[model samples]
Target chain A: MLEIFARLATLVVHDLIGLEAGTGLGDAAHFFVEDTLKILFLLAVLIYLIALVRASLNVERVRAFLAGKAQILGYLLGSTFGAVTPFCSCSSVPLFIGFASARIPVGVTMAFLITSPMINEVAVVLLWGLLGWELTLIYIAVGFLVGMLGGAFLDAIRAERYLQPFLAQAYQQGSAAAAGGGEAQRLTLRQRHDFARKEVGEIFGRVWKWVLIGVALGAALHGFVPDGWIEENLGAGHWWQVPAAVLVGIPLYTNITGVVPVMESLILKGLPIGTTLAFCMSTVAASFPEFVLLKQVMLWRLLAILFALLLVAFTLSGWLLNLVEPWLTTGAGAGG
Target chain B: MREIKVLGSGCAKCNNTAERIEAKASELGVEARVTKETSPEALMQYGVMSTPAVVVDGQLVHSGSMPEPGQIQEWLQ
Candidate 1:
């Protein structure tokens, strides 16, 4: 019995030492935890700052501005403004309600809603960071044009009647606030700070889980997915791959920030810029969550219009990306 | 005091709009009570189909756009 016990202990000790030398599991765990925590903290701080900035905005003035503009002009302006604003798809819904209630042209409101998520500052920054300046500029310009043209098309259809009944109620609330004649009060610096903190906490509290999940998936794909397979399957000149990628993106929902890392990895692996961009846009603009939220404000017909617009926009953007990929990649490789 | 409500489904934008309103109000030295209304029923009641709809003193002020800080300050004044 004593001899058997000694043999077993020796075997266990040898296996443990071998595993430690080969894997360094402890070190990897520590790194992962450290990196993830850093990301989480940064996200929190960003959320707080963004929230504070958003909180200071004047909704009534925007309403007044939109209300006074012509339909086509309103849409163009709204689209332009939306590109500068940082709201995501889900967050844009309230803005949609406000615009609709204010009796802003449906086309203009839709333009703003679409552009707000598709062509945000973060998206632009990430695109520039990962893809370079020309592609980033193209993305912004094309995205803005898509929003403007799409809104014009929808407006021609006179799609306003299709807004859900609740939108009217939302308008009523805005009017009620305006009616109260309390629009003259102001806030102090301390109050603004508290508001910013609370707003950031609340917003981040709800969406952080989704952000983390998206990041985790992106990280896994980045680390584990085979670069060779992606290049062969989805590389330029694959006619069917563009549509397939766009289709693949529709069901998946993630913020641009979460998608950026994966995009960076794919580009490194020789995936075409346009195709990857289409996929990213589809995921962000045509997400299931975004559609679900729209159900509250838009009827089926209106939703269909938005969906078709996204599909066409993404497809066109992808095609355009393919056209320039050769030149961009060559320039980048030579420069590097 | 004027009553205000920020309506949203708890997304980041909604939260941002809410905070903006608070900041704007504070900047203008407005003595208004601001609240966040996240319930679907309350949103529906206010005809808010989106998250982060701002209702000031029981009126709906903004719904879709994140208003500029100076503009919000103007509204508060």
Candidate 2:
């Protein structure tokens, strides 16, 4: 699909736009057009599918299920749902509000928030296209585990003690109100479709510019950045590369849409898989904005714990990938 | 004409809120212009920490989740 889109973009740029190949302008434009179209196309399709699944997941059903689940299971379910659910990136506020209002466990909600942005369908599609299916699957599995374990650990530590008092009070009131009217409303197919369509529109509206900017950066790096610079600085030889990638990634925030192309370029240029994955995961999962959003409901301590937990988890993931990359590449070449 | 803005990020509930507001305004035989704000900054500016919020004229009538149909009707009127 990406190849076809790349070809179409090439045809348009070379034939329609009349831009000659090998020039800086031609290369950048070609990269931009191709990358943007591929990302957008994947975004629309994946988000729609996720929306369909989410519609069936139904808020009331999820709340009811969580209310009855075991402690470990709740964290696992929260993060697993977060990975598959479509709303993690921009719509987290509402999910947070919903979970709080329903009086879902704070730790469980934290798990969901952590996994949602990290492993949504959009991120998976991009990873599959850009990095291949094996890595995408691996990312999904590992990312889900991170959320589950992270949430469980936090809960065990009684992290709830750290949430803002006002939020808990609000949650208590919210739960009281919701209890009186808590009923599942089955949505028709058309309603689900409309909901999905608008979700696509809303996300597209916010991130379209970032897609361009990210792709442009990727393209620029592809065309101009010295080939060995990334590899030599941050590639396989250095054991510190994974941690460094995580640290750098936190301060630099970009969604999978913006980060994936850059990831593709770096991979093609021999940047080590572990370092790259760590950076990608950190950029999407452990960033400052997510923590900032958490602050609305949590005191500094809980927010700090979440960040530390994610940073550690992501760093471990990076090292684990480093250890397994050779075995993975030798075995399957990561989805041929 | 009443200027009503649905402050949200284009999520499911936001779309529903926008539609209900439009429908309620129309049902009441009121002339109204409704706008959807999908920008995060703009939505947050209206204090919509949670989405599917309603801004009537320039004031925040509701924020953080969808309002009930009855509430929508009251706001529109």
Of the true interface contacts, what fraction does each candidate have?
Answer: 0.31, 0.19
Report the poorest 10 consecutive residues by lDDT, candidate 1 chain B. B43-52
Best by lDDT: 2
Candidate 1's C-alpha runs over 4 A off are A1-54, A84-94, A128-132, A165-188, A329-336, B1-77
lDDT of 1 by residue, A74-170 (tens): 8778887777555656555656766766667778887887777777655665466445677677667877887888888887987776777666555
Compute DockQ for each candidate against the true complex.
Answer: 0.20, 0.18
Query: Model 2: which docking level applies?
Result: incorrect
Q: Which numbered prediction scores highest in TM-score against the true structure?
A: 2
- Model 1: residue A57 alpha-carbon error in angstroms: 0.6
Where is model 2 more than 4 Å wrong at Cα? A14-28, A56-60, A88-94, A97-103, A168-183, A330-336, B1-50, B53-74
Model 2 agreement with the true structure over A196-291: per-residue lDDT tens digits: 887788678767887888899888977676768876776676778788788889867887789888877777667777777788888988666667
Candidate 2 Cα deviation (angstroms), residue A316: 1.1
Q: Candidate 2, what DockQ?
A: 0.18
* Deviation in Å, model 1, residue A27 alpha carbon: 14
